[model samples]
Target chain A: MRAVGAEEVAPTSHPWEIQADGLVVRVGGRRGRNAVNELTLRLGRGVHGLLGPNGAGKTTLIRTLATVQKPSAGSLSLLGTPLGRATGLRPLRRRLGYLPQHFGYYKRFTVREFVEYLAWLKEMPPEAIPGAVQRALEKVGLADRADDRLKTLSGGMVRRAGIAQAIVNDPEVLLLDEPTVGLDPAQRLSFRELVAELGQQACVLISTHLVEDVAAACTDVVLVSEGSLVFQGTPAELAAAGTTDHVGDSPIERGYTALLSAGPGRSGW
Target chain B: MTAHHPGEQLLRQYVRGDDVPADQLWAVEAHLESCAPCRGRLAPDPIAEQVWADLAPVLDRTPQMPPARSWLRHVSHWVSPVAGPWLAMILLVTAVAVALDQAGSVARGQISLVLLVAPVLPVLGVAASWGRAMDPAHELTAATPRAGLPLVFRRTVAVLAVVVPGLLVASQLTGASLTQWMLPCLAFTTCTLALGGLIGITRAAITLIAGWAAGIVLPTIALSRTSVALDVAATPVWAAVLAAGLIVIAVRFRTQSRSS
Candidate 1:
């Protein structure tokens, strides 16, 4: 926080890479609830951890940012371009990488082939795909398994494969929903390091229930409950918001429960 | 990464916007990138004038791209490995039909088995290509920018590319006229796509195939004559149906893009 002086001398004064104003997204179908309802938030370069309980609209919000779902009402934009413009979203999609909560993949494809295929989908240059896929696999510690079929991998390796494809394009905005769901403790550590490195240039959003991951790697924490913002600040700030009064295992956990209790919706847990 | 560094005079020429000969330019650029101290020793670039002069040509225009290997990857790009099995099934069914027609299986006056199977061959392929249960990457693919009509049409073309030729050969062998089968085949495929845009592709294909069996193929097979749907009088009607299906597809995509 004390580095404000240095930031002022930086080239661009605009820091909000992702901006949303009264954003509302409907998931499921026409009868579905507004999963992301009237939410307004801004994010910049650095890893932002999205923390919310199940059914809190974390996945829905992540889907909207990934451009998989359209906002039913309100305004949303990415990298300074408001979505739904006449220019089209194809250009923006090229600069974005996303990993869904379920992370569906073709079992018949090898690790390298799958990542390369996704690179083609993201529309990377053909000449650049081979090297990019190699580097992404190496980053996720899957270089040796690149030739192996996805069906032959362990659960953690499949998750790493998903991560590899998500990063193959070196996207400007990376959205990962429940990315660490199947990763083991060791792989999760490496995953956090990789995410921190990516956050140097891209606006990386990690939506998960793991407060420990947020505390260890995230530069900022965003707490939402029932599709509304409960808190938005640094991890340290989130910890300080709690006391002995709240019930949780860790400081961040206590802070999370505290904020949820104060919010409009009650987190059953 | 080398231990040696470029001379001060050469570095100065490189930094001051003066021409550094090609012989030395590559070595100097490579060295400055790896050696930060040599970079710090250089004069300032307030306007990045040196950068503009040195790197402009490379940055201004992209290098020429290699032409796509139109024979190989062009097919693989639009089709998945899963399509291999489904396409094989379509061809296998076509072979069976051709065999049955040659054997004089029912009677000389009977409808050729080739015409009975041609229309629905692609319907099976289309169904397999887009079926959610069949493709594990369905949701992931939908997230990409090319996921909608572009993907649908690509797979459609890929399926057609295989089955169309196989059907052509089979019909030719069975003494069936091209116009008798080709137009209805196309019309049925387009109708599947049109209804696919509304109810979903897999369901549309199942409904159309079942309808073809009930209303057309069954009666033709039992009566040992050509069905009214494939009769010569209905040729212009098939053309109209094909055109209408295409319009529906276009209109559906337009309204979808608008509402989103």
Candidate 2:
């Protein structure tokens, strides 16, 4: 600990908020390795939205945060511990939730069964399994149909169930990848509400192409284009960066497209 | 003071399963629930209600075994479909062959080879296809922390469990006395399973066929002192050696893929 008088010192002790320092991953193979260069980010509580075009590596970044895929070249820390180092992730996993863009469940499993399974994977104590299942189902509004098998559920319902499982453990950090992709309008609204509510207690990272979701639900935005983060700021700040002549139907869309197309040195693309 | 929001109450009722109207329910009861005040509340609550309705089904699903179980299950996925029927057939053939051998018609050596190698063919075929099946689509959700090992191991375990038992039954049915064939059967099965795991199933099959051909042809052509029957008895030892090598290769390949 540094002296109390020192401005650089943390007064007592501080936990590391999630941090990523210079991540690089190459997907595909020898024909031509597609390089994804990810910038560093340290996020605290509230909803942080990751927005970008197709193949922007938003999914890759989310997977890395979830510890599902390792970064080819970088160090990532969750709560002050490096990822995949035998010790850190196991415990951190108990406090982490992830919703992949494409999720699959055992077709034979019922909704309740899937969540219970996830709860088990999350390493929740035996006694808390049922309660956790109930609470998570209630939060996602799935308690009633919990007895129905997954194969019987509609696509939207499946997606909702996926979200419920992701949040079942009440993770401190929740990473969602295109979570509302298949939802009906009403379902999407409820999911957005759930994200907003969950954000109050945890650091939630929502990765999606929909600007409206980021605009309405997220506290901040991280925009990635061609595997690089082009911008990071609030909605207003993001809007300001795109307002050229100051008149457009939807500045967010215009700005995002502009950013995606801009070459090496240009700002925010 | 807040007026009871009928919609909120209804939404809660729906979640609780109380609002699901039965065939015998009174229209009055249903109507009491459909008033404008209730309807207005239900409109805003629909989104939440729908979300819960959708997710409720997922909560009913079952939990799978942990990492160990998962590995076993995945292995079963590969093994069961391809190996199960073949094992059953092998057992049936072995029973018939054993009956014949007991009746004193078929040779012991021929019955033994058929019983041992027949069931393994299907497993070898499926195992070889694994290399082809290692497509990007078969890849599990990359969002998991396990680095695909759990997924790969699960499939492997399930396959081995199915294949091993089948081999044992076939050996018994071939009239190979349990006391005589048990250890060798185990050794053979272990070797083949490990080899199948390492090289593509196709290569394992080719190796098996080539070994059998060489065993029969080389001794005959060279007029060797050792009979093919004796070489057959020593087959288990060869499998054990091959299995050890495959294990090493599989481990190295797995580590290399992950690091790359």
Candidate 3:
């Protein structure tokens, strides 16, 4: 639950890595309802936690950030490059690392091979791959199991492998959706440490339902409901929104319930 | 210990952005990890500073052997493990068709079952090579920067690599001219990809397979003769189809990949 002030981190010369302005993403069909509705956010270098209930457009927003899906309306930019332009997004994609909520893997690939393949996809220099793969595996504590095939590993280890692939390229923008789903408590602690370390340079956005995770790791928390952002601020600010009547085991959870009940239209810090 | 470390000059060269050899750079990095004083001694240039910032976290670790040998690595990129059984099945089907032709049971007049089935073999292989339903890693693969045409083409080449040689051998055994099936085979494969960019590969392959079976294979069997499309005289037409398919695939690839 430690928060690093933006002033403590070196200011980035590049524009916000993720800037979404009045972004609207509709799913189903042409007249489909909004999956992400008029959401706007600007993020730089830090760890951000996105919290919401099921069907709150967290995954939709993450997919859009990953550039896997186009917004039905509004504008988005990654690394200062505007999306939906005639110019290709490869340059921005090359700098992105994404782990989807339902991460898929080639079961036959060894952990090392999986990470290396992702690095290649990211267009890392060929010579730098071996070293980068090794470092990424080490960061995720999967170095010992680097040679093990993905199918042979436990679920938690596989999740760790997903994280390893995400970081293999040392991405400038990292989007991880529900990264701690299968991890044990100890692994979650280590994952938090790793996220803290990555936040020093990269803009890290993690989408999860675990309020404790948001409380413990996030420098800032964004709360969204019904496809729109309701709150954004430091974890303490979120906790302050909690009322004595709110039901939760902890301050962050109380804060979560408080804001979620209060719903959208609350001003962000 | 000597005051001047052996890596000092190399580290200086590294900082100056001189072309330091990989091993020398590695050595200097390894030495600097434990040698804080030497690290401080190296004055920072912006380029070198950024390089170090990026590399310092990742380079000090012990290097592991690359996950696969170069050839295996290339093969893995081209096809998945599930592709092994699928390729084997394609070969087996070709062998069965060759056997039936040799036995004279499935042969209708001059038409061989092998010839009838040859054009779609690579299509089946290409279908198996990619698809959201077929590939367990499709989601992860799709999210990658290189996931579109390049990947699709790589898998297609891999399929052709296996299916083409098998069909060539089958054709030799059946005494069928290579042009009778090769051109159409190439055409069908390209068309699968060309259509795949729009409708998806599995659907394209299935549609092509169903169309060929109904339009050519069934009619040729019913008439006890080869279809005109598979005739040696149709080589030029097949060639034209192949060319068009390639053009479509190229255009579609450029548009789809650019949009993605």
Best by DockQ: 3
* Candidate 2: docking tier: incorrect
Model 2 lDDT, residue A69, Cα: 66
Which 10-residue window of candidate 3 chain B scores lowest in summed lDDT?
A: B60-69
Candidate 2, B44: how far from true, in Å? 43
Model 3, residue B137: distance off in Å is 1.1
Model 2 agreement with the true structure over A112-207: per-residue lDDT tens digits:
777776666566665566777888888888888888888899998888888988898777789999998888888888888999999987889999
Residue A42 in model 2: lDDT: 74
Candidate 2: Cα lDDT at A140: 81
Q: Give the TM-score of candidate 2.
A: 0.64
| Native-to-model Cα distance after best TM-score fit, residue B196 in candidate 1, in Å | 3.6
- Give candidate 3 regions above 4 Å deviation: A1-14, A29-32, A265-269, B1-71, B107-110, B253-260
Which stretch of 10 consecutive residues in model 1 chain A shows the poorest summed lDDT?
Answer: A1-10
On residues A154-240, what C-alpha lDDT tens digit does candidate 3 reach at each position?
A: 999999999999988778899999999999999999999999999998999999999999989999999899999888899999999
CA error at residue B221 for candidate 1, angstroms? 5.4
**lDDT to native, each model:** 0.83, 0.63, 0.85
The prediction achieving the highest TM-score against the true structure is: 3
